[model samples]
Target: MSEFGQVLRGAFGPARVFEQRPLAPLTTFRVGGPADYLLETRSSDEIVDALELAGRHGVPVTLLGGGSNVLVSDAGVRGLVIRPRGGAIFELDEQHVRADAAVTINGLVRWTVLHGLGGLERWAGTPGTVGGATFGNAHFTGQLIGELVTGVHLVTRQGHECDVPVADMHFGYDRSRLQDTGEILLWATFRVERGDSDALRSTARASLAYRKRTQPLDLPSAGCVFRNPEPGRDVVPDGIPWSAGALIDRAGLKGTASGGARVSTVHGNFIVNEGGATAADIRALIDRCRSEVRRQFGVELREEIVCLGDAPVISRS
Candidate 1:
């Protein structure tokens, strides 16, 4: 073990510090090499301790949630990868609920419906944990998760634990201040309202059905690859509509393949792995879509997916 490994084991115990852990099984993309150190944390205190230990050892840290909306490099990640576990939800009141960061969005949605809470039903079929959703300000059916967040508990990279109000979150279209600050989300409190159970279930079912029909759910994917171009900031492609999927479809790149990665035929914004896709393959397809969209229509597509480690180079041919 190295100096950092020794310190980590000394502080957090040897059982918590794992070396050269495979990362593919931890992600939805099912691609990537391995993490040099993997720390499984069950609570906010453990997360803070892990971060403090890494800081003392001068070792870097990566926070992974439900493993959605990310593209891990084939070269793998160096340093420690902290995965928060032991999801627990606390009912603050009849109209408020607090949950750990590891709680899945789908699980939260289901829980809300079961309790007749009406705020997160729109994200019924969304994948990933509350931490990932809050990091990216996840949205579905015109509803962003950040809007319902009342408070966020996080540990800063500097090892300080603080509670951030929702207003300070700086939520925006597919973005939040957390993205820039590199803070590790621990838990969150959401404000909800009492609603009819049957009505909420109906809405949830409809949302799930819509995703099943429009999204390529049967295949492995990291969800939407690009954010829709903001209105008034960019010129809308003629006859292409003002959506990312529409623009990519109009560019005639749907189903385009690079190695094992291919543009999802059901949704142009998603790149699916057919069987044995590499990070390079996915990057190539993303580059093609961006280039073609920029060339044909004067709009620069922006990626929404987070790429970790060294980025793969895409070949132009």
Candidate 2:
């Protein structure tokens, strides 16, 4: 054990902290090596304290949100993994909702629609958490979380907490300043719009039905593997429409496999762990698909899935 790990164990206590914890169960991919140390924080204060301890001792810290869009390496992660508590909701203004970083995106969407909020209706069936959504600036059906984001509570590297306005934060397609900066998200507020309660419910149901029909929501896969590239820029001003999925599927990339990871037969863009999939397996499959797609269509695909750990390297280039 390193000096930082020892100090972390002492400061946070061994009971709540896990040593050499497997990260597979914590992620949607169900594949990854163990994290050196895993800290499950229940409150914002704990999150600040644990991260501060890691920083003081020169230990790296990786915040695990819903773990939906990430691919952890087979060799696992070094340093510490911080996972905060989930499913806490706070009511704000009449048309606003605040939620802890750990609440799943599906849960938030359901709550928003139940309360007559229409803006989040289209996102009702999306997987993952609000923090991941915000960090990735997630969007679907012509809406980005950036549009509804009003503010975020940030815990910086120095363990200082501040309320940040979304406007002051830079957001591009599926990216935000929070991702580059060493800041952990505690909570966020969305400026939702009020609508007829029954109508909102219907909209949510319709959206959910649409997702069931289109996406491979039931599979064990990160939502979309790639952010649509620049060529489909006309679909949404800030995002790529006529996505890589459409292109890949059109190129007959669906159900393609390199190893254990296979492009979902149900949805070409989703690379799934049918069973016993490894990080290397998924990377190989992703690269093969990207390469083949680029060869056939002359369009390159950008991965939306975030890779962690020392997983095998596969380049489409």
Candidate 3:
């Protein structure tokens, strides 16, 4: 073990921290290199402790949630990578539900539905965790997840834990204050209402069915590759649908390939790994998809996925 590894073990125990840990298995895409130091945090205390320790050591820190909407570079990540594994849920009252950041969206939805909690029942098939959804203000059926977030618990970049109400979140399409503040989400409390379990289950089933039909869930993918073009900012051409996938399809770019990566025929927006796909291949395909959309429709499709490792989280180029 290196000096830093020994220090990390002293603070967090040897089993809690890993060196050159392969990250591909941790992500939905099942592709990526390794993290120089990967710490599995089981509690908020561990999270802040690791952050403070790494900060003092001058090592960069990156937080990896339930890796759904991300593309990791083949070169791997530098410094410390923290993956919080805390999973706890609570019904604070008749109107609120608090979930640990690591709780999967599907798990939360199921838990709510079982308990007859209605507000989140409609989001049954959403990918990633509560933290990821809150971070990105995840959207579905014209609704943003942040709209239901009543409050959030996060550890700031300075390694201090704080709870902020929804009013301060600055939730917008594919964004939240966490994006700007660089805070690590630990838990989120959401608004809820009592409802019939049967009704909620019906809705949940419908959502799962819709995703199964429209999304390329069979292959390895990072979900939608690009955000749909915003109105006024990017005018949609006549006869073309306003969705990102539609634009890519209209551009005749579906099934487009770069190495093992290919734009899914089921959904033009998803780039799936057929087999032996590299992060570089996925990235090249993303670039091609954007260029083709721009050339054909004069609309530049923005990325919705996060890219990790020696690059900006979201690649504009």
Candidate 4:
């Protein structure tokens, strides 16, 4: 074994750290290359340990949750990739619920509804973990997950555990301060109110149904490709919807294909891997969609799904 491998074993134990780990299977898109080193951490302590070790070695750290919102490069990711496996949920007090970052958004929704909570029912079919949701300010029709967050516990880049109030999160459309701070989300606390279980479940079911009808859920793809452009800044033709999907559809790019990746006919914003797609194929499709959208409408669409590894972002200009 190499000296570096011995060091990894020292920190995480024998065979716990996977070297040259293929990252494709871990993502919703099913298309990344590999991680130089991958560790599945069962608790926040392990995650912090990984961070500290990587920091000491000057290696980069990437936190992957349910892997729903990122596109990894075909060239793969460098340094350490940490996947948190913690999934604990607890009631902090009346009207407050605490969930570990690894808790699936759907699981959290179900638990909340089953426990007679109302606020999270609309996220019933959301993919990815609570940490991913909070990191990206995951949104549905009229709600962003950040709106309900009371606080979040995170490990900062300096290896300090701190609680950040909602006010410090700087939540906005598809954004949170975590993106800039290099903080690893440990857990988040949300505020909820009592509601009828049956009613909450009904709402959850309705959301699931809506997603089924409108999204191409049968295939592998990162959720939404782009953030909807602001209506005030980018005016669409009258009668045309101002949403990102509608804009892509109006640009006549639906069902477009690049290798194994194709723009979803069900939703113009989703680029699904029909089968055997590569990160390059998916990225080519994204570029095509963005270029065409710009040609048809004077709006520049921003991506909601983040690119991981060393993938080069297509110039928005």
Candidate 5:
């Protein structure tokens, strides 16, 4: 460990920090090597301070939420991993809901239902945190996070805190400008409408059931692998009306394996980490499917899962 690590240890202590801790246990996929330094923050203020310290010390930092939609390298991350825990800050108001960046999307959906709010129920089973969902512009029922978000509070890489109106956020299909701009989301306020509690619960339950039935929710995997491209009004064979998953499925890539990673048998778009899978295996499978899809259908699939760090490459063919 370096002298900077020693100083961080003195400031944060052993309980909140770890040296060379395995990230596999922290993520849903159960794949990845250790992070050089790990910091589990309990509040946004703590996050801001940690970011500032790491920035000043010239150490790279990666923010981890639920760790649902990422694939980390086997060689491990070179710098610090900051994990934030959201609690009562995700509470609801009369016509709006506030969620800390670390709050799970599923938990937020449940909160909306409990508070008699509508709009987020369609995303009942999403596997990431509110910040990840917003960063990715996640959508269900033709509704994206941008539509519900009223405001976002974030700390920039330079350690300045600011509130951004949702209207100012540039949101596209499965992509957010905030990601390119490098803003660390702290929390968000979402505007919602009143609805019957029982009705909201029923809607959420139905959406959850549908997702569980279609997606391989029992396994360790990121939600989706590719963004659905736009299609012309004509629903022809060359049109992009169908999703990338359907395209991969039609290409006969479902249940295909490269090392320990497999295109999910239930859903072709989800690449699963079978027991003892490595990051290289996932990357290989992603490449294989992308290659085959392009060769067979002429449609290029764009990755939705965020890849972090560099590792040894694996060959699928």
Candidate 6:
């Protein structure tokens, strides 16, 4: 074993650390290269230890959750990739629930509904972990995940664990303070309301059905590709409104292809992998959408999907 491997084993034990782990399989998009070191952490202590070790070794660290909103580079990520496996959930009261960051958003939504809790049913079909959703302030329709969040438990880059309240999160469209801070979200507490279980379930079913009809769920995609442009912007072409999907569709980029990546015919905002897709291919498709949208509507669309490793190549003209 190499000296670094020996050090990792000593710090995290032999069972927790892996070498040269392929990252593609870890993501919903199923595209990425590999991580030089991958660490599976199930608790806050483990995560802090892994981060500390990475710092001591002068190696960068990347945090991966449910892997639904990210695109990993074809060249892979350097340093350690920490995948948190904690999935604990607790009911704090009749109107509150606490969930670990690693808990799936669907699982949390279902649990809340099963317990007759309201406020998260709109996210019934959402993919990815609570952490990923919270980081991006995931939204459906006009309801955002940040709205239900009361507080979050996070680990900072300096290895300090802290509790952050909702007001400090800076929640906005597809954004949160976590995006810039690189803090690891450990868990979150949400404020819910008691509702009729049957009614909540019905609402969840309706929302999920709408998603199924509108989204290309059968194919592999990292959810929406771009954030909708702000309303009333002059850059929005006349009659374009402010929908990202509508913008892409109007740009005539729907179903456009680059290698195995193609814009979804059902939802212009999604770029689906038609099997054998690479990160580069998806990047190319994203660039095409951005460039075409800018060309046709004079609006610069921003990406909602997060890219890891190498930065995306934006097209000019």
Model 3 TM-score (2 dp): 0.96
Give the per-residue lDDT of model 3 (tens digit) for 67-135.
Answer: 899898887899999898858889999999999888889999999999999999879888888878888
- CA shift at 116, candidate 2, in angstroms? 3.8
- Tens digit per residue, CA lDDT, model 4, 1-317: 65655677898897568888999999999988889888888777888888888888888889899999999988789888888875798988879999999899999998999899878898999999988999999999968899999999999977999999999999998889998887889999999899999999999999999999989999999989899887566666677787899989999999999888999999999999999988888888888888888888867888999889975534322
**Model 4 misses residue 125 by how many Å?**
0.6
How high is each candidate's TM-score?
0.95, 0.89, 0.96, 0.95, 0.93, 0.94
The number of the candidate with the highest lDDT is 3
> Compared with the true structure, what per-residue lDDT tens digits does model 5 show for residues 1-317?
77767877787786888888899888888888888888888778888989989998999888887888888888778788889876444445667888888888888888888878887887888778878888888888678888888898888988999998887778877777778988899998988888898998988889889997888987899878887756652132554347888888888999999778899999888988888898888888889888988887777778888877655655545
lDDT of 5: 0.82
Model with the higher lDDT, candidate 1 or 3: 3
Whole-model Cα lDDT of every candidate shown, in order = 0.88, 0.81, 0.89, 0.88, 0.82, 0.88
Kindly report which residue stretches of model 5 are placed more than 4 angstroms away from their true locations once superposed.
90-93, 232-236, 239-241
Q: List the residue pairs that clash in candidate 1.
A: none
Judge candidate 5 at residue 52 and give its lDDT.
89
- Alpha carbon RMSD to native, model 4: 2.3
Q: Model 4's lDDT to the true fold?
A: 0.88
User: TM-score of the candidate numbered 6?
Assistant: 0.94
Candidate 5 C-alpha error for residue 190, in Å: 0.4
Model 5, position 86, has a per-residue lDDT of 65
> What clash count goes with each model?
0, 0, 0, 0, 0, 0
List the lowest-lDDT window of 10 residues for candidate 1: 308-317
